[model samples]
Target: MEHQIDLTVEQDPSRSYRLLPEAPACGPRELTVTLRSSARDVVEIAMWSETGLLPQPRAASHHARLTIGADQIASLSARLISRWQRFVQFEPVSGSNRLREKKPYLHNANLTVRPQSELLAQVSELAREGAYLLGELLAGEERALVRFRGHLLNVLESEDLRIRFDSDLGVPWPMLAVGCERLLEGGRLTVDPFRLFLGHRHQVESTSGTYPDYWWVSDRHHAVGSANLDKDLKNVPLADDVLKLLNSRLKDLNVRHFSDKLLPDLAQPVLDEDVMYFFCHGSYEEHGGRTWHALRLSDELPIDAPLVDGYRKPHTDAAARRNSVALFHPLVVLNTCFAGAPATTGFTGLSAAFVRHGALGVLAPQIAMPQVFGAEFALRFLTCYLDEGLTAGHALLETVRWFATTYRNPLALTYGLVCGLDSRVVTSPQEGTTGS
Candidate 1:
C-alpha cells in the first residue's frame, strides 16, 4: 500500500500533519510526504508511527532516515505495527550523499554529540514530556514515566528536523509524546504515523454444537504452595466482572467461563471460539538454557504444554518437551504480567507463543500491571472490540486513551497488541457485506 500526505504551511496551523491510512498496510508501503513551502526555509520533518512498532534500521543505514529531492519524491519502507512495540524515529535526508561528511549534531546544534549521553538525555526528556501530557490530558493528575531510550537513526542530515511517533501502547507514550512535544514546544512541523493497522470483517461460521464465542479463563485458585505467594494472595475479581460485562453487553454472542479445571483443555486447540480471555499470573522461566513465559495454572503447573501430557504427566518431567502444539486461532487476551515480554531468542512469551501457534492476536502486558487497571482496560477494550465493532488495534488505542484520560497513568502503555492489529471479533452487517 502507498499513502501521500500534502502538508502546506498555511492550511495546517500547528504544522502538525495527520496521516490516517484508509487501512493497515498488509506489507511494505511507500509514503510520500510533500511539504508545500513558498520559500525554502529548512523545515524539520519528524515521522511517528502511532501503532507503536517501527521497523529497525538496516545495517547499511545509520538511522531510519530518507532523503528526498525538492520534487517531493522519496522511497521509504514501512512496516505494520505489532503489539507491545512502540515508537519509531526517522531522519529526512535531502541534497547529495557528500553531506554525510559532517559531524553528528545534537538537536540541530553544530556541537558534536556523544551517543550515550544523548540517549540518556532523550530518554529523560521523553519521560518528562509523557508525564506532562498525561497530566494535561487528565486535568492535573501526575503519572510516572515508563522507561524508554532514544535510538539514534544513522542518517546524514542537510537540515535539522526529525520525525517521531507516539503510539497508544502504554510504555512508549512518554517517548512519543516527547517527540511530539518537541515539535509543539519548538513550533516545528510534524507528521503522524501513516502506516495503520487495518480492520477486516470476520464471519461467524456455524458449527454443529453450541461453541463459545468468547472464553473467560482464570486461575484464581493455586495449589497449597506457590512460588509467588503475594500474587496468589492478592486476588482481584477480574474474570468475574469481565464475564458479567460480556454477558450483559454481548447477549447475542456465546460467552463461557472456566477456572483451574480448564487448564488442560488449553493444550488442545480452541477451535470453537473467537476470543480467549485468561486472567492469571505469568512469568518467564529458564529451562534447557531457553527462557519461556508461562502462565500459572496451579502452584506446580504452568501453561507449558510442551512439558506435560494430556493432564497425566508429572509436572517435573514436562520440561523435556520443547515444541508444544499451538493453540487454535483465536484472539487471545492474556491479562497477566509479563505475558507480552519479548524473548531473548525466538518468540518466547505467552503472547508470542499464542501468535506463533495461529492465534489471531494477543493482548498482554509487557510488564506487571495493577489488577484493577488491567480489568478496567480489558472491559473497555472488549466493549470497543465486540460491541462497537472496532479492530483490535483501534480498540486498544481507545482503551489506552480512556485510561490516560481517567487515571493519568502511563502504565496503560504497558499493554500491547502482539499481532492481528486489524482483527475484529464482531462483524457488522455492512462491514460483513463489504468484506465479502
Candidate 2:
C-alpha cells in the first residue's frame, strides 16, 4: 500500500514561546518551527517541548541556545543541514526530506527512520502494515543545532534555553552533543528483532540508491579444498551430507550448472550458456591517513568497461570474459569481510559497485568475523540456493536457522548479507534467452 506522512506546524500566539514562532505539529520524528525574531544572542528554548519519542513533549523544558563568535550562525545553519541530511540518508525508504524555512521565526522539517530488527513478527508487520507503523515507530529526536545567518532576532521558547558560544567555533556543539547523548542513552525503539530486520530489508528495497547483491566487498579469500574444485575452477564446497539434504529439496538439479564458466573477468570473456559467479575481495585501505576499499583485478584497468560489456562474448578478451569477473553486477556474490564497511567508505564497496553495474544481487559480510563461520555460512547458503530452489533471502533465513540450531547459540552476530533483487532474476546466461 501507499505510505505517506504529512505534518504541519503553526505559531501559537496564545502562549508566549521563547522560540520566535511556536509549532504544535512538531512531533517525535520531525519538527517545523518559525522563529519570530532571528536568534543573534544565545536564546533558550525547549527542544522537544512540542513532542518526542516518549509520546509526550519533554516535561522539563530542555534548553537549546545559540551564542557564538562572528559567522557562528552560518556554522550552526550548516550543521543543522548536515544533521538533517544524515537522518534522511538512513531513512532512504522515504522520499527526500523537504525542508523549507518560513523566514524570521519559522522552519519546516520532515524525516523518517527505519531501524533494522532481527525478529520475525516485525517482518510480517512491515510487509502488511508498514505505513501503519510510520507514526509510532519513527519516534525519536534527531537532534541538531541551527545557527542562523544573523544574530538572535528574537528568542523563541523560554523554558528551553538556546545557547551559543563563540568558543563553539568548530562544529555546532549543540548538534553533536545532543546526538551523542541520544546514541549513548536513547537506544533504538524496541521491536521484534526479526521484524526489525525484515522492515529494514523492505525499506532497503524501496530506496532509490542501488544495492548490489553484496554491497560490501570482502577481502577475505575462500580456500577450496582440492576435492571440492571442478575442472572449471568454481568452488562447490558443500559436504556430502549437506549435498544430500540439498538434493532432496531441489528436483531436476544438476551440479554442473555452477562449474561451467559462471565467473568471468576482464581478462576472461563470456559465451553462450555461460554462468558467472564472482568472489571478490575487498578491504579498507589507509594511505597517508585516508582509507578506501582495496580492489583486486586481473588487470589494473577500471572495472566499468567489462561490466558495460556484460555477458555478450567479447573477441579481444577471452580470459577476462570466460572467467567472468564483474566489478559491478547482481549475479556476483562477494563474500568478503567488511566488504561494505560503514563510516568511511559507506556503500561504495565491491558488492555495491557490482550491483550498480548489472548484477541482479549480491551476498557479502558486513562486519569482521572468523573465517570458519563465514565459509560455512556461504557454503550452506549456496547449497540451499542451488538445491532447494530457494530465493536468496529465504536461503539466508534458512541458513540463520541452521546456525541457530547447529551451534545452539542464543545470539549470533552477522550483518544482514542481502541479495538485492527479485527472486525471478536469472543467474544463467541462457535463462533470459527466448524460446530455443
* Error of model 2, residue 98, in angstroms: 56
In the range 1-436, model 1's lDDT, one tens digit per residue, is 8889887676532112122234334322111111222223222222323232333333321122222221221110001112112221312234764443232321221112334334334334434444343333223111211101122221101111222122111122211232233333354323221100110111111011112122122111110101111235235545455666555544233432333445444444323345766666766667677766666643546664343233323321242253332225467788776776442222334554455445567777765555666666677788888778776766766665565445433344556565555566543333321111
Model 1 residue 43 lDDT score = 20
Query: What tens-digit string does per-residue lDDT give for candidate 2 at 1-436?
Result: 9979886765532111111122222112122222211334433333231233222333442334433322433344343323323322222222455433222011111011112242222322322222222111112243423322111112211112212121211121211111111121255544322222221222111112433222222121211111111222233343344334434433222332221223343223322111123333345566576545543333232232133334432432342445433332223444444543333322244544444444545555444333334445656766656545455555655665565445422111233333342332233333332321
**lDDT, residue 274, candidate 2:** 13
Off by over 4 Å in 1: 1-239, 249-264, 267-270, 287-290, 305-327, 343-347, 427-436
Whole-structure CA lDDT of model 1: 0.40
Native-vs-model 2 lDDT? Answer: 0.32
My TM-score estimates for the predictions, one after another, are: 0.46, 0.37
- Candidate number with greatest TM-score: 1
Candidate 2 residue 33 C-alpha distance from true site, Å: 25
The window of 10 residues in a row where model 2 has the poorest summed lDDT is 104-113
